[model samples]
Target chain A: MASLHSAVLDLRRLELMANGDSTIHRLDARAKVLVTLVFIICVVSYTRYELAALFPFFIFPVVMVSLTGIPPLFIIGKLALLCPFVLAMGLFNPVFDREILVQLGTLGISGGWISFASILTRSILTVGTAFILVGTTGFTAVCRALERLGMPQVFAVQLLFLYRYIFVLTEESGRASRARELRSCGKKGLGIRSFGSMTGHLLLRTWQRAERVHMAMLARGFSGEFRTHHVSRFGWAEITFITVWSGLLIFMRIFNIPHLLGALLAGSIS
Target chain B: MSHHIVQVKGLRHIYPDGTIALQEVSFLIHHGESVAIIGANGAGKSTLLQHLNGYLTPTAGDINIGDFPLTRATLPDIRRTVGMVFQDPDDQLFMPTVFDDVAFGPLNLGLSGSILEQRVEECLSRVGAAHLRDKPPYHLSGGEKKRVAIATVLAMSPDILVMDEPTSGLDPHARRQLLALLKDFSHTKIFTSHDLDMVFELCERTIILHEGLVKADGPTREIFNNADLLAECCLEKPFSMQNCAACGRPKTGL
Candidate 1:
């Protein structure tokens, strides 16, 4: 009953976030998608040795999490796990070739510092953009956006099927895991053989469930197409939101504006 | 006499494994009539219903719905009109929300904007499930889910509604509510059930299937009165039939 209650709670939370009345949530998923794309491209086009310029790109993730009410920790946590690998690849520049590139006259910095900064920035930007896109829009809206933007009908339908059945399959997997645990309590406990058997049984159950679902869909007049009730409304606000975001990203990327400002402010203060 | 909305001729179905599910099963169902296809487990009743909507291609013979042949090409159109509701509402109402599930068929049919909303709303009301519009199918009670599943097809505005054991696993009140909703529908309706009382009450015509064949097809009254045929198909007479022994004529006005 607790599990059932939690399952229901998770579903309710997802539904609320997905169909919320917030302006960001209400914007056409396509618009959000376009904004995310533009933001990522701007971030990726930055010079690999540039670090200060990439700091401004943090605005994208911040705005996404704050405005859309998407959990920031989830996106940040996911990115934290992924970005380190790409960042580590760039870390080798400082180890083998630490040549002094620019002398601040009063301060000292090496060429490896700039390259390391660039690598870190690139990884952060790419991961941040991905996080913003998925965290705010969720998978269902993202699929609908893709479909509306002329994605192949087959792919779109496949996505919908995957989304619908994933929950069912996940539930079955959980049940199988629990059953295995219960049965093994008095025995040598579950091993690879039991795990394989559980997986096999789960697959068989899912297959039957899929067939039943297909038949059910046929009964309800489904003709190899996916449909939903929520229609995303594309408006001038959505257009303007993307336009403003894109312009800001382009401006920052085209002119190293963040670094220029940082230097000017540092010079003026000193 | 009403027009026979569904006409089947020598319908046969064999699984790829060569297990025969239906053998030369033929029947006629009139429009605005509730017909119950009753049988024991594995009696080809479910297989027969599947054929009606072209869910399973007939191994041989033909099934004609209103004039259109049930075939690969015609399956979509047949599905649009036939509206098959399955035994498990969980499988039927797979959408995240009741409104989405109900609106699914209409949306697929390309009805947009206000017209789509109107159709979905009307269907939900028809099934007396308007209050559950925003609720998820998984969150709903079994009975509520069943009604919502019925609403999903009802929203399509189909001509024929074929349900596989609609009353199965429902409590008596839920069953009665479902029966009432079925009785109110003007569409050609066929539901499979072993609930003899339900069959007697709502279905004017009854067909008993046994071992992949149509064993009996006649008026519900006649079918129920024939104790020998009922026992032969492994269905017992309803306990509510008190005057059946004294009355030689088929009972009327359930």
Candidate 2:
């Protein structure tokens, strides 16, 4: 219940940050979304055993954090929370293929270890980019941009509704959980059965709330589409942003900047 | 014009499970008249209000909003005429921000540019929520959210304002502010509430629903004065009508 309450607040904090009047936040959502897509593709397309090449990709999120003025610690906390999922996914990799693939002085690393590190790094970069995108551009604007970018109308609307209702749904469930926690004297009946029934009631209540919301929408002349009045055009700045960031991402993808830098440093030292 | 009038006759609604929520309900509210529908918990007040806006189809009855009958074809026009503010502000405000939620209806009506912005501004100011326009609905206090929800309905320029529980879940100050705002609206207003004091203060007409039927319908004072009738229906007079607690004498007019 406490986590649920914090989750609601965290979502609100991120959205509140998006309302800042900073330059990066003002850019059309489409530009940020397109650039983030390019960044994700570039980061994920790296080969399975390429660990050193992934270091350069961190620059994008770092730059975004500084420019957008979002608290780096908050984004970092979110990233850390997500790290375990990525870790669990790649945990078995080192056990499967132990053939030595790289040699750094005496410590020989196997293919599985290199690939596991690569997977973890890639996930961090990709997920970090997404978080930065949302931090700069609010979720509603992102949904609108996605709709304009050829995503199906229903899917875009569903995503927006999902984001909007998440707070309400979480708050309801949180209350339900707190109620159960308080009513279960001596911690009896605090197991899965009560949780299951509480969740079922929560689902039922959520369904009824959804129906009421749909009715409210209908009463407002909602024919189908959610019309927005504040129209933001992708202008010169957007074009420049997309072009420069995308070019940098592609360049990072094509060339191993980290490897080249390491070689140059070694040569200069010798 | 008849656009502001709401008329219902022989309205009956039986849920699919065979429990009748409303039975033989009828009322005709004139333009600019404020009416309060009051009843016990299972008295079908909400079920009746839902029928007014066409959210729930009556099993057997005819509802006429303005000149047209309540049917799928005329639903849009009826909705435009009768702006419904639901009980929970959360249900009414689904948009991300207060501005967007206030502008949702007008935007769906094809408003754009400065005109739309002006409309949103006007409604927000009407509810004294202009400062909270850019904030998301989830960030607002309960009273602010309720005001924004009212602003959303007001943006549509409805001829008749229908509220389920306008003053529910509000502190005394917020409830007073809402009552003042409702008093200033020069249009037909219909609402359902358990706040008997609010019902007595705002509505000139009061309808009592008991067992999904119209138990009594008349002037607010007369309806509240009939102690025997109110007792039969398991209701009581508004607090303002009761005697002074300390002095044990009748209170002055509300």
Candidate 3:
């Protein structure tokens, strides 16, 4: 119960960062969304053994965090929450293939180890850029941007509703859990034995709540469509923001800056 | 003929699971009059409110809002006539910011550009929530959320306003402020609440529902003054009325 309460609060804190007044935060949401999408695409498009190339992608999130005045700890904390999934995804890579790729000092680095590093680095970069996008632009603006970018109205509305109700659902579950805890008196409550019934109860409650919410929407003239009043224009600043970010991302993808710098430094010293 | 702004005739709502939620419930609300529906939990208060705007279809009954009958085709117009403020403001204020939530109904009605903005502003100012226009609904305090929820409905410019437990979870100061705001509105108002004090202040007529039936209906003063009837319906008289009776003072004007 305590963790659930704090989790809800932490989510709110992360979203509150978008309220800051800064250059990055003030940028058009559409531009931020498009740039973040492009960044993720470029980072993930790298080859399996392209660990060094993926390092440069970290600049996007770092610059966004600094420019938007969002706390680095907050972004990293969110990243940590997601790290387990990414780690699980690449955990088998180190055992699948054992082709020796190169020699670093006395250790022989295998292709599997290189690819594993690449996957982890890529996951961090992509996820970090996404975190920065949401932190700087806020979820509402992101939905509006998606709607304006020709995504279906229903999908955009679903995203908005899902984001809005997550808190409500969390609080409901937290309260229910608290009630169970109060009655269970330090016994093994909320265990596997009770999990099924608890989930079923939660589902029923959420369904009823959804019905009430739908009725409320219908009462106010909602006729099967979710209409938004946010009017986003693709002006010069938005265009420039998208173009500069995309151009840089494509440049970084095409040319391996880390490899080039390493070779240049080696040649210069010799 | 008198203007019956809202008329519910023999309204019977049966749940899908064979539960009779509302049985033979009938009522008429005149224009510009405030009515309160008071009942314990599961008294079909919410089910009845849902029927008013055509959200829930009656199993066997009729609801006429203004000139439009409650049907599939007239749902839009009926909803436009009856703006509902939900019990939990969070459920109503689903939009990201207060302004958007306020503007939702108007936008759905196809009012756009400056006209939509003007309506939102007017409603927000009317509810004293203009300063909360840009704040997200989640960021608002409970009282502010309730006010914004009212503003969201008021922005549609409905002729009749129906609310469910408008003062359910408010502090005394917030409750008093809400009562004052509701009192200032000139539209036809219908609400369901457990707050008898609010009913005394804001509603001229009160309807008590018990076990899916209208146990009593009359002027608010007469109904609250009847302790026996209230007790039968599992309701206590308003504290003010009880105090008056204890002091042996005459019932004064509200």
Candidate that would win on TM-score = 2
What CAPRI class is candidate 2? medium
Expressed as tens digits, the lDDT of each residue in B9-110 for candidate 1 is 998889999898887888878778888999999999888887888877888988988878877887788888888888888778776678877877888788
Candidate 1 chain A, run of 10 with poorest lDDT: A1-10
Ranking by TM-score: 2, 3, 1
For residues A1-270, what per-residue lDDT tens digits would candidate 3 score against the true structure? 787677777777766677678877777788888898898889888789888888887888887877888889987887787788988988888899799998989999999989988887887788778777877777878887888789997898788778767876887798889888898899977578898999899988877777777777877787666555545466887888888889999999999999899999999999
* Model 3 regions more than 4 Å off: A16-28, A96-98, B1-4, B111-118, B243-254
Clashes of each: 1, 0, 0
True contacts kept of each: 0.73, 0.88, 0.78
Report the backbone clash tally of model 1: 1
What would the per-residue lDDT of candidate 1 be over residues A1-270, giving only the tens digit for each residue?
246535544544555456555777777789988888788788777665667778888887787778877776755655666666977687688876578777898776787888887877777777766656654565667877888889998898898787667767776777776776678886758577677777789999988888888777776666776655557678898989989998888887787876688789999999
Q: Tens-digit lDDT track for model 2 on A1-270? A: 797688668867787677777878889999999999998888877788889988988898998989889999898788788888988999998999799998999998899999999998888888878888887787878888899999998998898778757776887888887787788865866688676888889999888888898899999998767666547788999999999999998998888998889899999999
lDDT of each: 0.79, 0.88, 0.84
> Which parts of model 1 have CA positions greater than 4 angstroms off?
A1-12, A43-53, A69-141, A148-150, A186-190, A224-235, A254-258, B1-4, B225-227, B239-254
Model 2 residue A190 CA deviation (Å) reads: 4.5
| iRMSD computed for candidate 2 | 1.5
- The TM-scores, one per candidate, come to 0.82, 0.95, 0.90
